[model samples]
Target: MASEANPRQGRPSMTSAMRSSSFIKEHQQYRPPSKPENHYGIDTVVEDLQASKISSPRQISPFNGVPSAENPPTIVESGVSHELSHPNCTSAPGTKYDKLVATLFYKSTSPRVSNTVHSPVRVPSPTRGQSPKPHPSDSEFPPNMSPSSSIDTFPLEPPASEPEPLDHLYGSHISPMCITSFLHLMSTFPLPPGTADLNSAHRCLKLDATHDYHPTVVELTMSPAPSLDYLSLEDLRKHELIYRFEREWNTDVVLRSDTLWRRYPRLVVFDMDSTLITQEVIDLLAATIQDPPDLGARVADITHRAMLGELEFDGAFRERVKLLKGLPASIFTELRPVLDVTNGVVPLLRALKKLGVKTAVLSGGFLPLTSWLSGELGLDYSHANEVVIDETTGRLTGEVKGRIVGKERKRELLIEIAEKEGIALEQVVAVGDGANDLLMMDAAGLGVAWNAKPRVQMEAGARLNGDSLLDLLYLFGFSDEDIQTLIA
Candidate 1:
């Protein structure tokens, strides 16, 4: 029956034969397997999927999962094309079994596995005719080296930069205009050729908002042109640009060395008459003469001329002393308590002594007052003219016995005291208020004129017209706390 039926079928229509052949070819090629492992082997499927053909629909992805448009995953490869789309990402639409398999494979073998999806790899494509790059293998990275596991792989914060240079501005009252003009002078006046950006970076630091002296100090930080030579305080006194500004602003403009500003002076020499004390000792002595009641007035006029640089100091001094011929030596004892000591002298000298500074009085006044002041103020040295006392009467003999402690003598004494103390002349500071003090002031490292005459103020290194001499401490870079502690 099979032969007869098959012969009939074989010789029958060509449509029947075509149907059988089509069914056998189509069904046999896609026969369903008993197990998923037999149908989809990841290792074998990956090998057949070439890097260039990764986009082919026919190939099975090693990471089998549903593709996602919202949260795409990333894969790192040394030189592989980043154009490869992760079609089998677990978030993509897929069967539960496929997603489970993908999750397991990714957790076990993926180099970067995390809860959060990462950005797609953006490796640059290879040039024309270049070979496709191989993907990075899992074995290349250590277990703890992944970005998910290690902190070292993350970018770190950068280190901080250095702070700027700081300087202190000291004055009783620092107005906005004062600061502005001062900054302008420093930036523009002393610069060398091609120097630019002077004081470009500036900040003003005010320590106390409410204090005894308003704006007594302000900390300034600025970057000056490197090539510019800062003029000394002495030169600045006469500098036309600064002099004009100072005159207009009623401020003393000085630029002291940062080194000198911080260093405490080892020796501080003070001029006597009209400086340490309020009155000239000679004028005080001359006032005691009875014969010529106008002698004191005449001597005072001459002393004023001598101090103002109108008359020679030695001659004026002798002329004044000649008028004091009959004054009883008891005048010295009488004048001791009545001498009007300038304000802040006691605290200033006390502070200086506490700092181990050797203080001295280089005076054109007679020896008695200078000696008394040195003892009273704890000064280390005293030098002054010696008046000849009459052995017969305990009175002045109308003459000076030895060398006059004039301007030249003051300068010499400052040097001698510094040298004797084993201190350098550059460590000396001279404070005075007369024309005679000019030479001595210029000779020392720092010279401060205390409410001096117009000429003296112009010639000295610095002039203090503030309320108290204690403001001098500010010039030395001592703060409120530092000065209070030192003086205390």
Candidate 2:
């Protein structure tokens, strides 16, 4: 009865404890074994080891699942033993146990299985001018780090590109033309090799608007400037330029103090008919005689010969006059309105006037026509052959009144004018386009061939193939604005 009472007393308390907690009842629901079995058996361990051996040439390292070299696993010592405790699997820190674990882990994790030397993984180096990237091995943020809060520690960014300069571009402001593009042009343009390189023909000089100093390229020598005129057309072909030389237009040649214009600023003498005015004056008179074909052709032939130094000018004038003996005296007036002046004539003459330079005309063409042009162009001096007329009949008398204005007369006139103006010969500039004009060209300080005959172009100091007499302003170091002011 005492034992029964004691057991019965404990039953009620046990029932109370059981009612307080239902965990033991839930545990009874699972029917698994009392002791946990090795999920990875000896067969599984042996199979894993064989697979690793067959795949990799490298010897397996022993010690948990850590590789023999780098990239060691972050093994948890507490869990590794329990996980690797099978009969055949590696569990201890001994060589045999570690080799089994190393083999298993290496086979599962390594990209390749080889004993051969492997190149280390390459990290990309930063590109030039770019900021370097942060490495993955750098200190990691704490697990509690917020991305927004980490903005203060951000890596550097690449810099932005710089803006291009605009002041040097065209239309930014109206600047002087760059003359480099025209430097190597023309028969007598001064062109020496740039630094002894053949490719140097392309090199051009840049000069300032003031025209007061050295060229950006090598300074041009006056002595070598005329060398191009001596080149045979074939030889000149060897100095072929790929393009014209100019930045827009420059004053390199004119800026050189040695240039004829810069060294001496004096007189500028011009031819009357073909040069100052754009016609052969005698041809106009011959045109009025088309009624007599023989007479007109004979006069034109004589005129051509006189210009080419083929016939004496005095003889040609008398013979051509005999052919024009019966022409109307109104011929000059009839042809006056139809005259065509060369391009840029007004601008060039205006520039010359502003400079206070003396101007003259030495012409084999008629005095009546040249004298008329002298007054119109504001000439300082004028000399040309005169035609005598029978006053009663008002017709040409087949005679010249004074000496014929041939090549010698033209040269003499240039010298006389330069002397009258108290100027030296080197201070004189003569420009013409005929064989007869060569004599005056040789006498002047600087002689330019303006759209002249081939022989005249080849012999003259410089040649202007372009029709613009405004180009003459460039030779005197005049800027576009300076020329415009002269015109205005």
| TM-score of each predicted structure versus truth | 0.61, 0.50
Q: Which lDDT tens digits does candidate 2 get at residues 1-488? A: 45455555546343454442444433455433333343433433443434432333676445574333244433357556333322222223652211100000001111222222333345689999989877453343323231344656743442332222221342121122222223324423433443111111221222323445323322222222223344532234233331112112211122222434453467999987778877788877887786776766777777777766676766777777777777767777677766777787766777788788899889887777778778877887888888887798887776788788877888998999888889998878898888788889889876777777766765676566554676665555444555678788
Which regions of candidate 2 deviate over 4 angstroms? 1-264
Q: Pick the candidate with the highest lDDT.
A: 1
lDDT of 2 at 429: 86
Q: After superposition, how far is residue 260 of candidate 1 from its true place, in Å?
A: 4.8
Query: For model 1, how does the per-residue alpha-carbon lDDT over 313-428 read when each residue is reduced to its tens digit?
Result: 99889988888887788889999987988889999998998888889999999898899988998889999999999989998889999999999999888888888889977788
Q: Against the unseen true structure, what C-alpha lDDT does each candidate score?
A: 0.66, 0.57
Flag clash pairs in model 1: 66-92, 67-92
* Cand. 1 Cα-lDDT: 0.66
Model 2 clashing-pair count: 15
> Which ranges of candidate 1 are over 4 A from the true structure?
1-172, 200-213, 219-233, 260-262
Q: Going through the candidates in order, what is the number of backbone clashes in each? A: 2, 15
